[model samples]
Target: MSAAAARRGAEVVLGLCAFTHDSAAALLVDGHLVGFVEEERLNGVKHTNSYPANAIAWLLDQAGLAREDVTTVAYNFAGRHYLRPLLHVPAHLVDRLTQTRAIPRARSFVTVHHRYRARMAQVRSQFPKAYLQSVLHHRAHALYAFLSSGYDEAAVLVVDSLGEIQSTTTWHANPTLQLLHAINDPASLGYAYGAITEHLGWRRGDEEGTVMALAAIGDPARFRPLMSRAIRLTRDGFALDPALLPLRVLSSRYGRVTSAFTAATCPPRRPDAQVESVHADLAAALQERTEQVMLHLAYRARGTSGSGLLCLGGGVAMNCVAVGRILQEGYFDEVHMPPAPADSGTAIGAAAAVWSDTTGRAPGGLTQRSYLGPAYPGVILSTAPRPGLSARRLTEPARELARNLAEGQIIGLFTGPVEAGPRALGNRSILASPLTDDVVKRLNATVKFREPFRPFAPVVLADKAADYFALNQLSPYMSIAVPATTLSQTVLPAVVHANGRARVQTVTQEQHPFLAELLAAFAELTGHPVLINTSLNIKGKPIAGTPELALDCLTESGLDGLLLEGWWVTRC
Candidate 1:
């Protein structure tokens, strides 16, 4: 390697994903991730597509580096895909002229395209001294998953609504990643799920999880015949009918659905309307179809690559139910997904991809422990003062918190670093004893302000994971849902969902010391090592990223107390 190449390998590398949903920034030094955070966490937006300026600044400040010190800046989106919007211009004009507006307006696409270009230019101007490279969107997703899997070789699968032009892609990564098969736009499982989410009166992209939760209570057989016509599974892949599931209309939220679909199914539910049986049944059908397509792709990936391990990426991998089904099918011996398998993870992928290209070697050393964001260390009460809150330092933090939980007090936990992904593994979470019969109701109605039907997840000791859930593999990231053992269903009623499954996060002392200690203590007192673990944020907001935000959430919500670092805080 040349002198400059050696220096680049030793110096700082920045990764970013901007101008799209789940914008984020990540930093890698010597091919090891040092910092990663989502723009939504810093900006207080749920899933903002705006440029991640705040995230970039925070990562730089946290690393104690200036823009000039960065050797390379890797972007997660490819500029070559910008012209894709132009292809929809004719259809957009026709939609407007005909007054049907079944297709998204061309202006929306053009505006987004221009905005993306302008943001890219701004990024370039901001990092003039750094080498800038744009990694393909799906390629970045694949790299993140494959590298993080710690697998020498695996069958990689990337699935989302649309990454540039491709929607679903399969790869063979025998240490070196290579694309084997791809299914491009208009036939995406992600978009199909999103469209159904919107039709069920939920926000697309943001509220697909809600739809997934609702599926547990509905019967898929009610709408199976209709969905069968809308989405057809092929020998190798799947196809979506443009007439019923028009791709053009799905590009924007303002786009209209075809009258035929509305006639065949029920009318779209109003946002505030009560979710009816019909809506629930439709969600069930959509969830089932999504899983079917995912399995089909998984089988294809395994057949093509002949790899025993599978590494899944992209937004579709965030569907834990489908991921669990993939695992249960036994097509692949092992399956791995990063904590943030969605677009946020692409930031790390972008940096890793560029790092590998520059060093002529794969970027390694990423772990499943996702506590990669900023860490705040200090006296919480002295540094951040709140008018209506009182704090006291604890002698034994974990034991005290376990006792509090055993007493049925819901506690907000803010410790160490903020997690990178959406699920709060343990550091920033709401803790409650799952043995409480009314705990789920209290969490949903009083604390989280979400639909009561949405179930909470459980955090258990890693060694005791199989005792509670029928999980054959570790779920450190809460990435999959598995069937709850009979003991868990009866003992930890609050965390088990209606479908008899739970999204369980297993914690080892090596992965999360404090959480493991707390679980052990709780088990000593309550005879079960499980606790209801959910993000420390209210409805329609991002997870709390700072001590101040955690305190604010505690004051606003019905949380009994907050464990901030070594201090215990409570409302005055």
Candidate 2:
């Protein structure tokens, strides 16, 4: 999409991954992730499921552009054709038909359903002057991984619940690329994982990551055997045991599970319910099994394609544990996973796929960085700067903020470009004194209104990470789960999960010097080189982006301080 726009004289290409999970939009004037986010921060629904009209409008308004300036509209789902099948058939029928020999035909039937016509009409009506094209689902997934991976050649594995034609596919690519293999029939590893997630009493699509975290604390013994029985591996790849596991029950429409499944496992937990050891263990089983299947497929693809690098997409790619495992195991010499692995990222992927198909040019190189979304350029409103607040150099401001935090203040830190994925990486984050567990308890109960057991993550200085964690790599994406030392664990207990693993983000000077210095200043004061970092928001809403939003949160929230540049405001 960025290339096409660039070719057509577009000075800036904005890629919006909006209106799906997390409701965020990205701006790429050329070909970059200038902005990306989920609407949940703004809308307050856990996974806000509506178009990010607000985010879209906000980005354009901030960029000082008008709607007419957008030359083309490259939608991720190529119209309603992508989702038509889910409407008519029963979940069981969809599952059964998917496994049949005529699966391709059924897919076409679904993709070309009445919604396709309606979507086309809607497109014409909505963007009459803009060019419109529909890219297949998995193709988009492949593009997201390949483009962002920064590799010249690699094997791309796109796995997710069903797309236009298939669930999981393997694409072998160099500067030139080819679709090597596809698995459309017999369900997918993505679907299998989702099924197990639902059976374990978590919400299917939105709660899968939570299950992955829950896995680390659980025992997968009994559940692992059952999951293996339910999802059996075939001579070709993997298959579901339809007798034991009915794929239909896993559909979004399934809503709540049947009494039989819940009765067998345990009563399902509400989305906001407390996490139990049993649920944790079930999550563990599911995650372990998922890693097992992925490793098997990676090995197979590596041998078949003789490709050194692997590009991963689809919803399953969101499993950071699996990605980290793939990297740690050296399954492929180099494995790349896009920041946005879910359906929203498919928009950028679809654009890449369409561009490659039309021009026959392989994706040049991976995206150098993930600042591909929209950003606020310090719009100093005419209304007034909040009392005793002024934009200053990030250096001293960051240090002062750190000093306050070391003295036991919960600081709301918003600076630089916002993050793309689930983790709040310094730009749009809240920093607190990790030395005190009170921050966690108070924030969850008073501000976040979520489960108390859920833990905050650590933003540690890259150089000082060894003092706190035993890991070696930079966790800028907060993907891995590693243990904190016994001493560090005792002091920063709130950020550590039940199993003692911290989703630690290592801050380097290049990434954000301000945050890095803040960590240093914090260490100087308290001898702890990390701060408790959490998404800057209350429960059920997207993180606030604008100053008005920030100020409103400060007034309404139970926060201790606010830090935007040098301007720091404290409450009580």
Candidate 3:
């Protein structure tokens, strides 16, 4: 507690970010996080690219308080009113007005800042008494990483598409945060990667994961020489050399893109069509170069902060493959990153900043679980069950469901509160047997209906986690990737990625009693405690929060059953 806190007692703070990719709301009582929910989770819309009205209402409702109870309200974006002049020009208008990355970046900033302030007006009207503070983009990202990392003195690095005017920021944060270095617009590593994604006929923000997955199949060395011309390392940091970049052509859909990045003048719309050796090599090179920049920045941060721990945030930090590379370097004693490393988690950072300001102290620690969304009442046991589907309310869902799982059933498990972030953490997930690759192919082909090459993550019983994967960290959110042993891979072939690693979500009985019960039952049945657990949604859709959405997935997809809350629902 600080001097101010000693006098004022406890306070409630609300943190918000809207008009962003992952719109979210976070609530904090004193210094502890009470709830954090993304708009996408509740709305059933992927990315939820607008104001989080539903998320905010839930945050206040969950805490049993009204908007007036919040002493402070924190917003994620800053410098909007000041930076609007820099941004008012149209996106490609700068290219027509003055052909440079800086001008287009100005255009981008204007659009972002104006929209943010307009939304805040509505928020302010709702909570007139709460003291509102707007947090800087990179500052929020840094503070969130530091507080969530459980490190006392940690080096924090944030790299994203664009944050206000800058794209990359390196900081040494503890009591007082100091900026080590920052890389400005147009020369963004994040934008460079996004441009490549566009060139390869993929969605800029959404399909970066596909590029990461394809990297494992390609030879990074094939494109290493070419990538060098585009980016080079400097004494202080790295540089994005525009001269070496391809000539960008403006598109209505894509702001500024280059046709020369690909072999075709107009490529097929399907990303799967661009999955050949050339594209693979490009992806490999991109991943390799990105890892190089990240490792260098991390090592530099180690020295700058003089701390043994490192925490990374921003959209770039979501690249688990690159993150795995950094984990291998052994440069820092420990590294930590939250599950929602991207913009959504910034809501939490905004709240943390308010707490730090009022209390004159840093709340630096870690949160272990992520089932933070609203929970449902008891699922009604329908007397008149739907045709072609059987229903039974079970006292022991784990034991009953384990038998079905052993017989190769795909069941939708809905229980407790909804998960807050991008990843689904058992509370809202579709489960399948991990014994064979056929189940994965079935999941991709019939259930997810997305990319064939995209991999499924697993939820392992926590005690059995070390036996399967290399590390024993409490990966409750499947954020980190670790190599799986050959023996375990052979047994659990469905969940392992092409790169020989698995993004594992480990759950203990203490944290997730329902999931632990199911895992234990599966172990008793088949002697294996792993399940192919993926978010319960079709491709291009958000995970289901409401029971109706979960039911819809069961009917639309090839799912065999629906274990919703307490009532067991299965196809006849």
Candidate 4:
């Protein structure tokens, strides 16, 4: 082939994840990620598992491509794994027929085979000219972490509720990824944590972060023995005791812990029930146990791979507390986590995996900026003020916004491209002075409508991060927690958690110039370079994706002002 022909033959892959929470689509042009966005952001559904039709369309539109432009369509889940569940159906049925406490088992294996096949068919129909391929779920997760880490070599870990039959997988990526260990379903730290989250009166996949927050204020020793029995750590990996954790029962739509667990501990809390001290203690116990298991696995990974760096992905990695513990232990000299270290990120991984397999080269140099979603230019919003609101373009957004924040105004900031991951990262964030008294309470009650105990995160200037937080490495994506310095706890009280730690995102000029500038400007005014940063949405909603959604959030919430690209909008 001629050089031009060879270049044209390079794959344009469209990666997708559906039939699971946080469905998303990603576009990769010749193995490099060009765009990615979650379905929840576009559809306004929190943790929607529906096919990412909107996300795919938006990616193509943003890239100025057509369906025919895609040479490959890669799905983040391997449909062949449905056979495992199918094979268990007979055993489940036998248990159901015997009425030997197996009804739940039968329901758990309720065939998702047909649904998965239909979703595959839909994908094929959507991209008629493209070849469709399936990537193993955990492998996709591993590749996403390693490729985005920018590490030449690292030890990789992926822990989730269930990826096909495997729940936790370990890998060594010495520029070429290789699987080292795997723990299959029914023995997942992710499942154990989810069960505890459900038992604590929150949705499993959706509200695990709440359980993490509750853990900080509670006493882990109160329920340590019981939690240890429920999730026992082994030499290689952890195991979830079926008699206590009951993976089948917990995995069902109506999540419930086993009777043994209930007998040993307190009954499950209802969603609307008041949270008591016991519940907090249970959360703490679960968190502590999870941290222990994570550390154990990290040690094993280091010994097995002999890599000085670590990369983490999958839903379980969303537990920043556990990730923080790993960082604090210093088992690895460096740790890297992608912004979307969950199912949503599998889209990028699937595309990258397919590209590597086809081209015989890994996707190289894909920076972890995570600003690959839709971008709305500042000109998109009209200059005219809306009813009950005033709008004007700011000459110096950083200085003006810093001034507003210094005066104790909570501002909704919407600019640049929407972020691909769960973290706001300044482009789509609600910013407030972390030093403001009662700021956390006000943000939870008036703006977020979330539990009062839920703590907000802080985005700090990269150079000044270590002065405030005792993080071993920079956390550009808010991926891990770190101990707050005494100065930070005193000066930035709103962002500090009860445990005297904070999930911090450090911004450099290269990574996020606007956020860095704003932090510097705020520092000049308030003598602190940190700001209380959270997603630009209320609780139970995805972050605002568009100008209209951003405006809607501003009008609905108790925000003092909003920055819509260049325009500054405030209520009259």
Task: Indicate which candidate wins on TM-score.
Answer: 4
lDDT of 2 by residue, 1-572 (tens): 33344446763433444434554554444343334555554554556766667656655665556665554555566545444444534543556533432344345555455555665566456557556666666777787778777677889887787675477788886755578877763357776677667766666776677677677778989578766866676655677665554433322433332344455567766665666787877777778888887777777778777888887888887776676667667767666667667776675665565455545653332374544444556644322355634333344686778777877777787666656666677877888888874788888887767655567788899988877875666667676556777866777787777767777788888877878877888888888788888877776555665556666566667777677644555542
Estimate every model's Cα lDDT from 0 to 1.
0.85, 0.65, 0.77, 0.85
Residue lDDT tens for model 4, 1-572: 12243247756788898878899999887666778899888888988999898998887776667777788999998967755644555564554322333555444444565567888898888889899999999999999999888888999999898887789999999887899999986688888888889888899888999999999889999899988888998888888776676645323554447777887778889999999999999999999999999999989999999999999999999889888999899899988999889999999999889989988898754666588788788455455556888888899999999999999889999988888788898889999998788788889889999999899999999899998999868899998898999899777778889998899999999998899999999999989899999999998889998888888889889999999988899887
Q: Assess candidate 4 and give its TM-score to the true structure.
A: 0.95
lDDT of 2: 0.65
Residue 465 of model 4, lDDT score: 91
Structural similarity to truth (TM-score) of each candidate: 0.94, 0.82, 0.89, 0.95
Q: Which stretches of candidate 1 lie over 4 Å from their true place?
A: 1-10, 84-112, 249-256
Clashes of each: 0, 31, 1, 0
Tens-place lDDT per residue, model 1, 1-572, is 23354346466788998877888999887777778989888778888887788887777777666667788889998866755756755654565333344234344455656766787788889888788888899999999999888888999999998887688999999998899998876678887888878888989889999999999999999989878877899887998876677654334555434667778779999989998888888888888888988999999999999999999998889999999999999999989999889999999999999988888787655756488886788744752358877888899999999999999999999998889888998888999999987998899999999988999999999899999999988889998999999999877878889889999898999999899999999999998889999999999888998877888789889999999988889877
Put the candidates in lDDT order, highest first.
4, 1, 3, 2
Over 4 Å off in model 4, which ranges?
Answer: 1-10, 85-110, 249-254, 383-385
Each prediction's RMSD to truth = 3.2, 4.9, 4.2, 2.9
lDDT for position 319 in model 3: 81
lDDT of each residue in 1-572, candidate 3, tens digit only: 33244236558888887776888999887677878888987787888777788988888777677766778889887855437435534553545333554454555556655666777787789889788888888888888888776666778889887777667898997646778888766557788788777666788777788788877787888879767766677776777654445322222444443434443323434655646777777888888898888887777877777887778888888888777667767877667787678899899888888788888876533355467777886668574366676777888788888989999988898898888667878888999989854898899899999767788888989888988887646677677778988767888877788889888888988878889988989988888899989998888888898887887788889998888888888777
